[model samples]
Target chain A: MSDKPIALDAMGGDHAPHEVVAGAVHAVRERGLSVVLVGPPRVLYEALEDHRATKEVPIVRADEALAMDEGALASLRRPRSSIAIACHLVRQGNASAAVSAGSTAGIVATGRLRLKGLPGVLRPAIAVALPTLPKPTLLLDAGANADAKPEMLVQFAHLGAAYAETAFSIGKPRVGLLTIGGEAEKGNKLTRRAHELLTASPALHFVGNVEGHDLLTGLADVIVTDGFTGNVALKTMEGAVQYAFTELRNTVNAHRAARLGALMQRGALRDLQRRLDSEAHGGAVLLGLTGTVVIAHGSSRAAGISAACQLAADLEKGGVVTRIGERVASTHRTHRLW
Target chain B: MSDKPIALDAMGGDHAPHEVVAGAVHAVRERGLSVVLVGPPRVLYEALEDHRATKEVPIVRADEALAMDEGALASLRRPRSSIAIACHLVRQGNASAAVSAGSTAGIVATGRLRLKGLPGVLRPAIAVALPTLPKPTLLLDAGANADAKPEMLVQFAHLGAAYAETAFSIGKPRVGLLTIGGEAEKGNKLTRRAHELLTASPALHFVGNVEGHDLLTGLADVIVTDGFTGNVALKTMEGAVQYAFTELRNTVNAHRAARLGALMQRGALRDLQRRLDSEAHGGAVLLGLTGTVVIAHGSSRAAGISAACQLAADLEKGGVVTRIGERVASTHRTHRLW
Candidate 1:
């Protein structure tokens, strides 16, 4: 891979400009990776001063930025938005990849517009790697398309299969369709049709239908579903994890000995927390794009932003796009669904 | 109500007959409840011998029973099934309520066939009380109908609202439509349409829309969605809780101090576990039926079976069916939806 740096959206996320710049500097210094910050020159330059990285990390000026509260339309409204500029950098080969912690809708919309989709790719999917036993499970369409056709789901399976092979090195990745029941006949109209298509497809190692409970059990390498259900399932799992920890903390605090014990084993507990943390994986990747586009968590700080940069660089090196494109093209040719 | 007993499916669940008979005896002596065990007379009588409950708990013969793996079709195939007989007891006024731990689909199909729906009810929904802070949040359509129309969701909200009010004593219970986003227009076609209808309905205290993460936050008294999404969400939450506990256990056992601390705080931890246990809520209630019907977990033992019976008896006393009927009647009359 060329020494093309990852373009970081500086004016994005909750602690943007500063945290993002700090993360870029951390990547360059700690991880030995090149990064280019994208945002207004004055704002980014001032933020980079804290890390003494003004000269080390290059800055690409983006005049306007989409508000955090804005939707997909903001990508069109602010053509020079930090996320847009980051995508442009990837498109122009100035950067190997784009990483942004901006509004999910805005980033997805702009990435689609700037990088476009792989040939025969009906729609791009936001693939999130879930923390499960054995290995991370790849769940796709995590919010890219709220509504999806059966054909799109079949395509998603192939996209996820390729991603698993490239990112996680899972050969012949088993794919499961997310639905209410394990039976193939079960689920809503869309799922039933998709189940049939997936079962018939030769490219995907279809494992039939899996319920939401199978998500954390590592039943399949990739779980494919419409973006709405996928997004809800993802968030619901996150909330449950937090709720459990809060309950655990309260239990430990209820007794003195328990609190002392928790203190004693705080190291192991921290390790568990880190392993389960959503930000540890460096955010969701927008797959089926022409380039590697990583969407960092919105509330990410320095560590999360830096992790995302590292992930973008890794995905670029692993050739995720080319793998997905080839897989999609082969599936599209064989199935002729998309 | 009258001295009408709860008709229990002695042929249902993992430890059926024995556990069912034991639970009946427990419910009678501990809670002062009338109970009738429905199964093959010989099997129930032989099992009841262990508890010396043969004389204390009445037995009603139901020659046939549905299998654990059976679906909705089994309800018709085995008209004399224990679950069918239990529902028959409810319809015949011999039992005020029915409790079963058989296949959910079989119980639902039998209940719909025997008790039928309330006056204005279109489709029945399974309502489960989620273990959440403040109070258990009621989630409906846990898997009765895999597919639902937009208007069906409107009815589900009213069903859930009535259940929440009757079961939890929440007045003007706020109902939330489950969606991908908090915005009214953020979900797919069904959810988006349901959101609009819910927002317009004067019969409900609709609280816009809630994401999957809101399931355990007690954000709304009742969360309503299509059966498929609701089932997936409910199972996902359960899976997440189990995963967290497993992880916590591993962390606690990682060191001697942590294990000792866990032992010292076992009381508080047990209380938390009980509070979060789905079984503690006495399983799920099938709503919109003419009579109250509670479906215990299929793997439920004696204590869980007793809890389900208690829940059925409580719902009968709470007038859940009557309340739902009146609410649906007025709403249907007001909107002419039916």
Candidate 2:
């Protein structure tokens, strides 16, 4: 719906090139979205021909790609990487947004270099939408700022609130501080200070502290914490979910009766699985950037890539950056504590 | 096995004197362990009479009892509380260990106030055994110290290693510091410093850094972290498991075939559930204390209480506290950095 198409990094992700190209084609055909695949032109051209749609999706040539195992230094080492080229496309107004299932550190470093930050933004945060019941819960600072000042966390609340309002269409989204206890005085120094600031800020609809058990209870629209804590909590939950599913599978196949039962209830089980899937919510988002950037999971398949494109497009169209700018502008006028 | 009985707080947990008395009886009759019920004699006597266990377990008199919701301050307020009396009994050598299905903060506070700490031990940590495949993983500092120093983490590793050696009979337990990355340099100030200290300590078998996702993979025998992060990680996994089982139950009830299959696989499902059950691990153990102390879940029933008693008895017999004292004494001699 924007003037420019979304630029997809075809050389990113665990199953790069092949799965990425297939996702691009699927998005074009199924969702009626315009996409530009950025990678080696010859490889992309051949893949597009194999999909039997060479003319529909265009390819932009990029000589190199950031390795999956590389860190922030990769952004500098491979300036012409597919992810870098995608960011360049967004910066030049040739693309509405950028989506990549690449190394998070590399994507973040390059995004900052290319798109830069909006005015008054201290640091960009990664917000992952948890597939909780009724509606999804957005957890911010998933991994961007490993060490954070109290002001950064308060800013994350504003950023998360804006994303929740735009993406989930919620009015005055309630923001909760992720800490050890329900009381405001709980948690380490960073969380305690941030809690006080968030409470005083008129922009965020601040709720009391929330524990890890509240993540799936849909207790808050936005949960804010330091990147280190957030990242640990997220990964721990993900791994536990996998373990539970494994146990469930082993139990279901224990006997003929359970197997038959599992087959009959297969529809409901699949629905629940889809609802809880991380890909359903797209991926972790980098907030506070000048342009919309979505970093999909490194192991994401075609479905995840398509959802990442959808998330990037929706964020751009919804004016998330403009909303953040307005919030920062108002905070500057009223509170100068930070 | 020891000459002394395991003390149980009869007025603790959701089920109160009834479940506690029943659990004490079960520990004696089923597990061949001696247990003493600590509470008001009249209240405990009547409950024991109801279970026909009046003659099986001995009753210890305590004038006051700490409420399940009461915290650290309760130790000062109710000096004669059942939990405080249990700790006193252990210190007096009348009871080899203390087990309470009560507030973790209350138990930790009272245990510190009554039993004191081993020499050279900085702070006590609560270790929970995670039911990972192949073996149970021990996670320490599980809500004992909300704020910890770098040196405290290193000490925690030593404490956890001692526990793993004594309880699981492992020659040299592998210790992992829970952090964001496997690389040594990828954490906040606390973890970074702790990693360096742990690596340098000759007493522990340091296995470098382990991420949150590695909690259930049996990657290490002992995982050491600050109490706040450990509690969050543990509770998050518990919540996710609950959600998964709920979904599984819903799917099984979706149709007749699934229901029949679930019925057929009932034994295997129950076995898996029992293996993953928190109560089966016999609650969290308080290390670095002068005497063995186990804190059970607040909602624990008769079975969970009995398991906690079993854990307390096992730790006391295995001389977990003695092993910690030896480790601390050696670390004091060589690793004077802490």
Off by over 4 Å in 1: A255-271, A279-281, A336-338, B255-271, B279-281
Error of 2 at B64 (Å): 1.3
lDDT, residue B188, candidate 1: 93
The reply for model 2, stretches above 4 Å from the true place, is: A255-275, B255-275, B279-281, B336-338
Which residue pairs in candidate 2 have backbone atoms (N, alpha carbon, C) closer than 3 angstroms, thus clashing?
A: A257-B261, A258-B261, A261-B257, A261-B258
Q: Is the docking of candidate 2 incorrect, acceptable, medium or high quality?
A: medium
Q: Candidate 2, residue A140: CA error in Å?
A: 1.3
For all predictions in the order shown, the interface RMSD in Å is 1.6, 2.0
Per-prediction TM-score, please? 0.96, 0.95
Across A1-338, the per-residue lDDT of candidate 2 in tens digits comes to: 47589999999899998888989998889987889999999999999999997999999999899988887877987889999999999888899889999988889898988887989999999999987766788998888888889999888988998898888898889899888887777787777888888889987799889988887788999999888888888888878877887766666665555455647356655666655665423568888987888998887788888888888878888888889989887887778655
